[model samples]
Target chain A: MDRINVCIIGSGNWATTIARNVGRNVANSQHMEPIVYMYVYEEIVDGRKLTEIINTTHINVKYMPDFVLPTNIVAVDDVVKTARDADILIFAIPPTFVNSCCKTLLGKVKPTAHAVSLIKGFERGDDGQIVLISQIIMRQLKIPCSVLVGCNLAHEIANDNFVEGTIGCRDQKYFRLLQDIFKSATFRVVVTDDADCVEICSTLRNVIAFGAGCADGMELNENTKAGIIRRGFLETLQFVDVFYPGCRMATFFEACGISDLVTSCYANRNRKLAEAFVKTGQPLSELEHILIPGHEPLGPVTAELVHIMLEKKGLADKFPLFTVIYKICVGDQPLTRLVETLRFAREDM
Target chain B: MDRINVCIIGSGNWATTIARNVGRNVANSQHMEPIVYMYVYEEIVDGRKLTEIINTTHINVKYMPDFVLPTNIVAVDDVVKTARDADILIFAIPPTFVNSCCKTLLGKVKPTAHAVSLIKGFERGDDGQIVLISQIIMRQLKIPCSVLVGCNLAHEIANDNFVEGTIGCRDQKYFRLLQDIFKSATFRVVVTDDADCVEICSTLRNVIAFGAGCADGMELNENTKAGIIRRGFLETLQFVDVFYPGCRMATFFEACGISDLVTSCYANRNRKLAEAFVKTGQPLSELEHILIPGHEPLGPVTAELVHIMLEKKGLADKFPLFTVIYKICVGDQPLTRLVETLRFAREDM
Candidate 1:
């Protein structure tokens, strides 16, 4: 059999950082193809197209500035052109682009090609239900779509720091291929069959970051901050049990679960923005403009989305932290009294 | 039943800090007595007896200065005197004092009385086996002993910031009593039937804090820090499963398990000292003298104790993080390469 052709379907900072892992691992793997085709959205940076810059210089100069990607990795401008011949597709684009991108590649790519989405938030369906990005890809392209998520910070991974992550794949054959394609000395990969739990944990972590940021912004005790995080995790666990059932409790112990939540809570744009929102008494949008211009923090946005789903299901009170996060984001709840909010909110599970 | 008579053992900062919770809870509790007797080892603080200062001023001057304990918390220097008529004994003294203190209270307290140890470290039995402090209390005094552990930082609780804890009570009747004694608006109490896991989590948290502190000290990125804490918790989960079997994975989700670990990792003397050990090339004792002056950090000490037991049982390699921590403390392993140690150690179960 021919070696597995790998295609990375995004060129953002995370995508570029992960392309380093995927592109480099192909050098040593016997079962993976040598050339990795990375899809970079056509953009002009400094009078050069982004794809041309990445392909000629072996660096994602615009998204991931200084670090170099593997030499064998080729860059392509058209999404369909890059994905058409691949057997393993890695989706790391903004979650909003997943549906359209998958639609573009629907009949273009091999039906045997499976996907692993690194997208980190939920997309809403026409029925107003939350949909996993991998599900959208699988539904559009008729292929198995697993997910990869964990405490992997792009800059840290770029610097070659130790990182661990989980791959949620169901098939044993694909698991070994993925393990061979992504595992490196610094990047440890653990794969589980609970794909939905992996994606949900990645999505809900941003919401928990809001609570952790509020705790930090209020200068509440470490006890309260830790309690909010624990309670948020408990609520997420219950949310999985209620809506996305049949996942094991052990899945919550993986890198995609508690590790991702802890990393986001401690240090992330969302937590930082939430902290600024508390300290400056400004709306999240205003804080985003001032603190991190041009980029929006997703904590408050995800909070609103999760809140909408919970409210529609008539279970808003079931997740007090998530509800309170949305309330605080919208100024519906006074921030001053929330120093003890999660403490009194019955753990919300 | 008549109101439960309460005796608090030890009058250190934590003891005095917790006395505030016990004393305040009594005001709203019908099952508890109005007065609490706290044991204070005889000492002179600034020309006044420590017990006299607490009894007269409603404050523990040497231990918890400037904070007024509830007036109903009376202080006495005699251990047996405090325990003689009590029905709920709160043992918050240092672990070194547990054996002798329990021996003194043997056959002196009411036969119906029970214990709840606030100790955070392990005790070694005659065979060098690690023993829970509650086990020693029960063995010495022939009374049932439960435990209370969580992210309850003493100063934070004293300042009236929100706090949460778990009461590892096996008996439903005692659970209600403990729930009454520890619960407050700011002090939320969660009770679990798995007392042994709760106690083990409390004890092993110190060992994990060393890994966290080491990560921070080395200036490793947030991804690595979160990974270390997660791996440490994973090792602790496996540790519980091996020696103290039959505990649920759900118990580790409680305040005593992950919350306590997070709190200690982010902010505690053990974490602080471990960071200092990495920054300063001096020994732990030298760093303790410079930073904390009179008190010793327990993380390294507990690491050594746990290492001894694991070595005796031939399970040293099964806990890579714990073993590396002990090796780092004893200078058997270079601290530098540990940046990638746990990452490559196969998640040793």
Candidate 2:
């Protein structure tokens, strides 16, 4: 076995916690380089540069103040410099920033290098359709890309609580190495060949969680909320089956699918925001500004983008949950229609 | 389209709520007889016979005094008399009483009749393994049996709130008839051909829910609870796949699977009791007596039976959540071991 170099491509809340894991795992494992390069955007925090602060204190002081990073995780201000010598690149930036980040490292990276995406939402494509972040990374860098997604809460995982993640690698050749890089005593990993299916679920689950939030806003019974979530999952199944024809249905059973979906429905920020949106009778714009200033939850964002493609395909009526969530977010429809739309939709389906 | 008679074989909490749906659906469905007979064990409530009270007031005053049964549902004291003239016999009794109810109706049921079971737990078979209640009904009555199960709460559905149910009917010929007898505007139904898988999920999910309950009892983080649930569900998949092959993986995504499991873990008696068991340090026996006397949650009951079979098969370690939950229930292990056992079970599994 040859030494493998790993580089992390972001410095947000999720990225910093994952860096601690990647750094510690690489250090203890044989035939893997100890130094993990993490690309941090240039930021001034409390009269010091963020990258400089991390390099000295080994802590992501701005994003995750409580979590201490591994000493081997070196912070680099330049994206190209961080990824230039790496054998494995981890793209953990937000979905909206994936394209620019990919472009910066396009020709500088090794041609033999492989990439794995931990991005959770979708990016709007040039054709006005939603595109997976892994697809963007692969298309830009000309390398094979895999995905990792699950019920991971950054603060929880950073605190050494147990978390389960699914690695969707279409190639069996990448399984052992990816597993070694990600799996730990508290972080469990499962590999699946259904890459596209796993990635799509990460994007669609937020829309469903938003719907669950509206139900909570109305204080519906447990049975009714569960019923609404069930229908939303079915619609997600239909959406993926129709668009990604070759994706396996069984992949939806993986940690990236139902596990992530249910966890988000229960505790995701989207659920809280949507609940406030309905209960306070305030638009999402106002609620986002008040509750989480300048930060928009992924549910309404994904719903809006997904609704575009659904309408273009002339199938908006078939996906009632997404449509209702998108409409409610934009003030086009009332939140109460979620239950009615789900009930009147094809029960025999 | 000959007139079809529908018989409900119990008057318990869930049975009474379902009888309300079965009664109304039978009345509006064409070619179905307007009369629905429900078998009720004779009991005196407030010095009045329970069956006579149901017949007079169209309500099971003892079991579900708040729900109003449709007028067409006539209550009968004799189980045999209630099912003898029926074309579609519905078994809604608890798993423990399924055998006796089947024995009473064995020779009296119409030769051409089929049955549908709404039972949610498993009974110990003569061979010391857990047996699906639906299988017992089918074998004893000499008729094909389907199943209806989901995230249904008795009071929730009885109040006309929306609910989703999965009907695992392997026979396409019986789909139309079963759908007509069960589906309503508020009670939605979806049919799956994986009959045994659906039936086993109704049993195995209880064990998983018990694990979730134990996780809740510890006040573990939401991510950890979801991961435990995800692993418990995977164990459930492996349990069904190893013991009962030919079960589709996609069926686990249905209402009978994840929807019901999440709902139960969130609000079912099992989760509540387990929480009490941990917080108060009292054994389940004492807790059940103090909280709801004479009522035992299905989670531990099913866990005890499933553990026997798993241990007999020499694969107890593979299903750590079930084993831990069972051990915790019977005082063989402390509840604190739940988290440590889960963390050390199998990270790369």
Candidate 3:
């Protein structure tokens, strides 16, 4: 393999991480250094600020400090000139801005680039669709590019730390090529061909994160967290299985599925939203007003998605915990009272 | 299943739990009304103390108050004379005095009694002899009996809270017989014929508890603790697999193996040993000498046993962690340095 030039857009945490990990694989293959170009939006494009943020990250502090952008990293005031001839393009912007950003990039479309998405939230609009970032990219560019998404923790990746994640794309050659470019001593890359399962898993996990945040904000320990997370995965798999019968439910033994849910919900910023509710004794509406780009919406959206799916498929009886969380997040019910009622529901299971 | 009369020998935290869980079943079972007796060494034990000790103990406080010793319970002074014959007998005595205590009951031992043990320690002689509690019992009684042991927490059992435990015996009939008697809504009982695996798992766990406590005393968190526990399991299982081959390696996945190691090492009295060492700056040897009945020695003896077995078989390479721990504990080495070296050693594995 010759030198692989990797381009990352929206130079945020996850974006910085993929660049760092891919960049460190310089010596992994013969006669090659994966040269990574991070395109920072001019507003936050100060190279020093980017370096500070990247350096402050544990992943950078530990594994990929060398991959930190140089003082000469390109500050793109012009979007067209920024993505002129990218090879491996990535959309690492937040979901809300991704559609508009993709439109901005469509005019300067790098026709032959293979794209990967790192954005997390679902795009909400008039129809209120749970559109994935990859789908949005395809809609804008009129190109079928592969999607790569999984439980890639920013702190772990930034720390040059490795975590298990699935790199799923329909194109085997594209998947292997990406895997080889990203693989390092600590970083692990798992390949899969199921795009639907991968997308559903990536998007739906945030909903479970809402449930996990609720559990953690409540100070329920690992046992209760385990129960909640296990139920969430069951619901997730059940939903995904309807769309893709070949999807395998994660055995609780493999901490990846539930562990990922717990980390996103409790240890990360999403959990802080639920913690705010418990601490302030306020409701979700109040929270949404206060938290600009509030993490609370994932809860209601996930509850709605799971509820609509369960109701449509008539599988409500299978996941009692999901049903209760769905009711609590989206219904007219008081959470305190619902918690009291659902406490007994888990006793039988 | 018939309601079986169950009796525990100690008034310690664990003994009371066995009584409470079994007693509830006896009360509800149509076959027989259960009788639970806490053989308190102290007369008129304070219920408040018991409650404080067992925060949310499951058996009704009203049913068995501190002042009111149930008819089923006979004080130690009156146990030999007034105690009614029981179908199932549980010896929950402290392992330290088990031999002497069992010697007293030798003549009173019932032929049909199904005995179980909840102790997790080994006895060592001054000249360097090690004996397991069950081995002592077999030698004293001149008859074989079944035993149940594993990673069981007392507080949960006291409140009739659900937990997973292992039941092991040479005879499957005896193991299942004891299993049926203790099986209740809150208790999960898995019966196995491999006593050696159960013994190795239960004992080796305490040694890792010391390791965990040492880490916690030094201010480590989940990631570090988890790594030590995982490696420690491999170390313990190396010896266990040698002694008991048929026992599934996945048995380490049970609450007794990993979860118990985590809690006992980081959160319990076993871990508290590290606090004394760090706070007082007391030498471990001096501290161990002072706290003669230290539960700390439980794993040490098992460590020695493992070391001896490995040395004899020349299979020391199979378990590097065990070898390091055993050498550190017995040698005139600096405790802190030894612990630091172990943590570093684990990264390579």
lDDT scores of the candidates, listed in order: 0.84, 0.84, 0.57
> Tens digit of lDDT per residue, candidate 1, span B18-126?
8988998886678778899999998998988989989899988887887999999999889989989899999988788788888788899888889999887768777
Candidate 3 lDDT for residue B147? 60
TM-score of chain A of 3: 0.77
Clashes per model (N, Cα, C within 3 A): 0, 0, 10
Using all chains and alpha carbons, the TM-scores for the candidates as numbered come to 0.96, 0.91, 0.67
Model with the higher DockQ, candidate 1 or 2 = 1
For all candidates, state DockQ relative to the true structure: 0.71, 0.55, 0.10
Q: In candidate 2, what are the lDDT values of residues A178-209, reduced to their tens digit?
A: 98898777787888888999988888888888
In candidate 3, the residue pairs with backbone N, CA or C atoms under 3 Å apart (3 or more residues apart, or in different chains) clash, namely A58-A159, A59-A158, A59-A159, A59-A160, A60-A158, B26-B34, B57-B159, B58-B158, B58-B159, B58-B160
The CAPRI class of candidate 1 is medium
Worst 10 residues of 1 chain B by lDDT: B340-349
Model 2 over residues B1-349: C-alpha lDDT tens digits? 6798899988888888888878888888788899999999899999999999999998888889887899999999999889999998888887778888888778899999989998877778776788888788888988989999884576778787777778999799888778778877777777888999988887777777767777787878777777777777778888898789999877877778877878887877777788888888887887877875645577787888888888899989888888998999898998778877766667333
Scored by TM-score, the top model is 1
Best by DockQ: 1
Backbone clash pairs for candidate 1 read none
